[model samples]
Target: MTHSLRLTHLVVRVAVVALLAITAIGATAALRAEAVVEQVPPGAARAMWVWDTSNPQAVVDLAVARGIGQLYAAVPPNVGSSPQLAQLTQLSTLARQKGLRIDALGGDPGWVDDPTWVVDNWLRPAIATHLFSGVHVDIEPYATPAWQTSRSTVVRKYLSTLDTLVKAAGTVPLEADIPFWLDEVPAGKSTLDREVMRRTKGVTVMAYRNTAAGPDGTIALSAKAVEAGTALGVPVRIGQETDDLGTDPVEVKQTFHGFTVAQMEVQLDQVVAADSSSPSFAGLAIHSAAGYAAMTP
Candidate 1:
């Protein structure tokens, strides 16, 4: 839940109309959501998290210019009746027309406790609009203290919740946002990462480190999971942080903020270059769109 707050997913329910929030992106842009499902980008496709759908035009334009192929656009609750439904649809149409895939993104740590609520209120309605191509949920059960003590229980509920979404999503692919360290945790007979991969479409590891190489760098931190994903034939998208998380040393090292977009891309390029060799490495996904665009010139 706290991959530096994902900050976007934390309150995505409130700002589902903006298109500027960038998410994990791929290397090459795709033609449609159908083109993206179960298929990782050919090379280093880029994905952006667009939580703010307020400006659909700006969002699509930015994504196209950046060569981003996927948009994890947030979905508003009561989406079937929300005033911004048309705005969301416009964004979707524009994105797809420009060869970009848009996935309905929604999640809350609490959603794990009651998947039906989200299914009935958010997922079903959003999917009904036929505005999205896929479903991307960020249920970070780890954010709660219970994750430290009741991890097993939480993992069970979490997996169950995903199952419900997977079923409800029907033919639409469902993916999740997970921390980079999930592979170490046990989920029944398999590791959490592997289990999660088995349930959803694929995963975007919140690998948030700013550098490409180091003991704690992005590549090193995410490599094991990528290998596991490869073995399972699951796609993997490595995520980077751009939001400014001031001060805390460990946290500070996790973002690309304060650096220019060019500087951030250099690091992202390194990640794409390093991981592209793996079949599961579908692409790179930046954590936020606004932050990515706001990066220095």
Candidate 2:
């Protein structure tokens, strides 16, 4: 063969080799990006609820044993009846020892709209004494049609009160446990939406109902709750009930709620998997410590 022809053949080989190398590099980069995008693991964090004077230490210990890392203090009304201060202190001490975090410091839902009087009267005192990481105002304003139409007013007041309390506490997070329907409050309610997002540290959609949605039904409801929470720019904690959903004999021989702990975990997994892209998909919190402990998964 001519020397010139030989040189041309060598050049072609070099170009082909370079092209293959580029293709391999591009493929590797694409794989890395995909992995990053899907890095969120199912049920990466477990959360549970704790009520006043309920042996928070035992609850925390049980939670830590089951890979649960969050505890929300349930501060209900009839404040005189509940040992709010003592429970908070006990939980705080136990939480510190077990490497746990206080996810919330309020209770029994609907405190979100009970007027600023309650916050100033009850919440402020609790925060000053307990030093929890946040407050969980489980407000079900959707039950009130008046609040739904005039939601901005109720939302603003609730958020304002939270803002004041957070300012007093300093860096403390404010979270809310809300109903399933609030998921689609609509476009003009953007003010309400932004307020809900801004005032609280995070939003946990309470998706549980006693004798309510069946297993598949529960999972579908939770997915919608998470989707709505995402649009509002808030992290969602899905609340699952152990005593409800009947009893699942297939997963566990024992009969309880048709929804076993395993079923609840499946629902949670669905929510997390639905939006792996948004870290706003905070984590899953089972309703109460007792319920969580009874749950299989």
Candidate 3:
């Protein structure tokens, strides 16, 4: 072959290889982004709620046994008190030493009327302790009697309260617990799910269901919430109920009762299958430590 022809051939071959390499790299990056699931900070594989901080050792032991790396421990309304503050700090240190994240948990629909109190009394004190990694609020405005009479106004107030709390939290991450059906509840132009995701750092969806894949199950009901969170870049944790809520109305009772650990694991697997592709899929949270520990399987 002529020298010029040989040089041209070599150049063409090199260019083709480079093009193929670029295409491969692009494809890999796209796949990685698509499969990305947000890992909850402190690397919590499973999280459980703790309603009391009186016995920090007991709570930590139970959490360690169940592979729980996060605790949504309840903070007393008078959290600013010296005794309460000391207890929380000790609990936080113990949990952190075990590589667990502790988030201050507080909520009351009444707080909606005075969100400033929620921030000043609860959030600010929790942050001042410097023990909590984040704050988790379980304010269900719909539980109030006024919700039945004034749905729109109540929901708007709820959204406004969350907005204020988020701002008050400053650099500390704020997470809210929301019902899976929030998508069905309208709050002005947008649904509750959209507004909450837009305001909070993350959300724990109370996707209480016996199963995970059916029409009324956790995965199906949580679809809209996951989608909204994913779009807004907010992490979402699917929460399951393990507590036995006795003799409540059928609808209310559906939030808890009747689930073994094995069954819950199965349901969580389905949730992961359905949502693992989303960047907002954080992980799973059991309703409470005591209840979950009592369950069979």
Candidate 4:
């Protein structure tokens, strides 16, 4: 063969091999992702919020007994401390051994203004300990009185906070807890819920309602979040409130305190059935570990 022809032939062969290698890598990644998804039982992503880390073993035992697959637990802000770090490491190891995913949980309205502080001071240190699989921030900006006075500004700040957190989290997924009413709030040309979901790895919508199937129930309220998440290829976890808020006027609409655990399960079943078509419908997250334990079925 002529020298020119030989050079062209070699180049073409190299290109073909490179393309095949790339294709193989892509296929392998897709299969791995599919396997992970399959491992998660459908309609069985039972999760709960845990605040106390005093007795990690007790928490792990309870989670195992309840068939919980995930726990959003509160890690101490002083994760730099040896004792706090040790506690988290122990808890994380136990939870992992029992086939449970544990995420570092934190939240505050002030976090909107300075999310980097949370990332640098708490998230990074906790993650460095290799104790958390992800970060779950429950920053309810609406809780701040300033939200009423400067609604648009507050909304923008909240979105910026999520952006900052996502960047700082690096490979660690960052999830946010958002209110169900976020769909009703306008942010720029889109809704607040859409903006938040666009930035975070996943979202847990606090669809804190007593009913499940009615127009104003949890399922209906959570529909928008599920739809948005599905469109964005992000997972949406529907959160139900089980804690007793007593007679507090502010928390009147937040819980199913009077309902039995069986009733709550029935509601959750309805929610799962309603959102079953959405690939991003992650599953249900009960309000709290202690509260759920106290619930009478």
Candidate 5:
């Protein structure tokens, strides 16, 4: 090769190597960016079954300090109560400041049955609060064989009202609280099926009650719920507990209500794995912020 051509070839080789190094660096950064899930701080994200909006700042501060990502505040119905409004305003303001997402515009179903009441009372204020990122409708009419015939109708009406209410609430997302044992409910399947999920933004499975023990019971409960929800292709947030079930023996406390540290760890690990295993396991939300952090593992 001529001397000039030889120098040009060397320069080209150097440029190629430099380009490769830069590409490698970019790829590494991209991979690291997607590693957010791996670093999820323990009990950092949760969904609380809030009875009241009292002490908004304290709870929000606690959650933010602990690295919690989302907050699903359950707002109970109070047609004429001014405290609800004040509490919601406080929560809304705090959530915005802390950069936390609030789910659920209203509280539960009994309060929401009157479609007009739900619209005029619960929803309009949700838009005004501006603290909520989404709306969660806990519309439980129970799961009985006799109710099956009317179940679909009620659910459809509820979802329809929700669709209208959410639109009125502006850009907030929506989630409907479905029965925890939806998969096993043979007759009430239609009311809580993928069809319902397809029509809504998301779903929360309340997989426990105040009187339960053993993670095994709750785990089995959650597994079935998630499995059914996964087939629907939507986000399913698992609801576990925080309260120490009233028990006398201290040792029983360790295994009380199946939310033991080991059980929680196992459940969370399974949850993380399930998220990878299926399209439905969107994220996890414990029954309360307190319960989540208090979990053993």
Candidate 6:
């Protein structure tokens, strides 16, 4: 290409980047202008998942405005060369300045079959960027077909995968997402919940039920894992769902969808009341940054 054309190309690239920045900043400013910043309890641990990197600055702005303490920002399956790298780096810089912890969040059940590939291609490169505070993996092995057809075999493979992550993570904290009922799935002498907590620095129990109390409620479902975390001295964050989809939209109790954010706060306050005293309890984690932002105020 000629020098003039090369210069023009650079100008266009700069223009596109500047436009995106302006748009994200505009969205953040509008959100701040329209919304009353919700107060989170002082020193309370709170986190939200950020799956959409299309607007990292906007996500960070909301996190700061909302008093959220941590962010589990999603990365592409192969961060070694994913185009999302630049945005993620921007997010990390902004989040750190705002005193928030951001973890590289990436996982898939299929990853259980090849831990080395995941670590070499995704986890290591993401961490090597020095952009993330920790690693949060949501490898739901139970979601795979082999889990049903060959439960024992899949269970062992899942354990091996966790072992690989623990080693790969080294000093960087490694955390995993497990269903609240994983304690029922035996892993040798102990349950999957206990085994996972034993291996990782922390675990987020996806106890998605909206209610705080009762046989099938969030607190009740999370009790076992919370107890295990305490015994094993592992941090445990209880996760809640917020997506609009539900089996019965009108009577959905599994998620905060359709309900006002205020109502969900009331239930989560009850969760704090019940479990905040536990040394293992590490506050609450909303499932997705986008879903939480979309909740009715």
The digit string of per-residue lDDT tens for model 5 on 103-141 reads 643544554356777767776655555556667776665
Better-scoring candidate (lDDT), 5 or 6:
6
In model 6, the worst 10-residue window by lDDT is 1-10
lDDT of 4 by residue, 1-297 (tens): 010100110000011112111111111221010101112236446677887665577667656544567888887675878575666778889998977888889889988888778778877887787777788889899988889999999998999988887888788888888988899999999999999888887888999987787778888888888888888777788898877787785475668777766676677767777876678877778877656655543
Computed on alpha carbons, the lDDT of every model, listed in order, comes to: 0.77, 0.52, 0.71, 0.72, 0.52, 0.77
Better of 2 and 4 by lDDT: 4
Query: What TM-score, computed on C-alpha atoms, does each candidate reach?
Result: 0.84, 0.65, 0.80, 0.81, 0.64, 0.86
- For candidate 3, write residues 172-279 as lDDT tens digits: 888889998999988678888888888877888888876787788888888888898878778788888876676666554355456655566666767777776777
Which prediction has more favorable lDDT, 3 or 4? Answer: 4
Clashes of 3: 0
Deviation (Å) of 131 in candidate 5: 2.5
Q: 4 or 5, which is superior by TM-score?
A: 4
- Pairs that clash in candidate 5: 44-68, 104-136, 212-257, 213-257, 213-258, 214-257, 214-258, 215-258, 242-291
Report the CA-based lDDT of candidate 5 relative to the real structure: 0.52
lDDT string, candidate 1, 1-297, tens digits: 111111111101112232333332232222121111122325567788887777787778666656677899988887989987988989999987977778888889888789999899998998899888788999898876778889999999999999998899888888899898898899998889999988877889999998888788899999987998889878888889988788898878999978876676667767877887887887888878766656543
Best by TM-score: 6
Model 3 Cα shift for residue 106 (angstroms): 0.4
Better of 1 and 2 by lDDT: 1
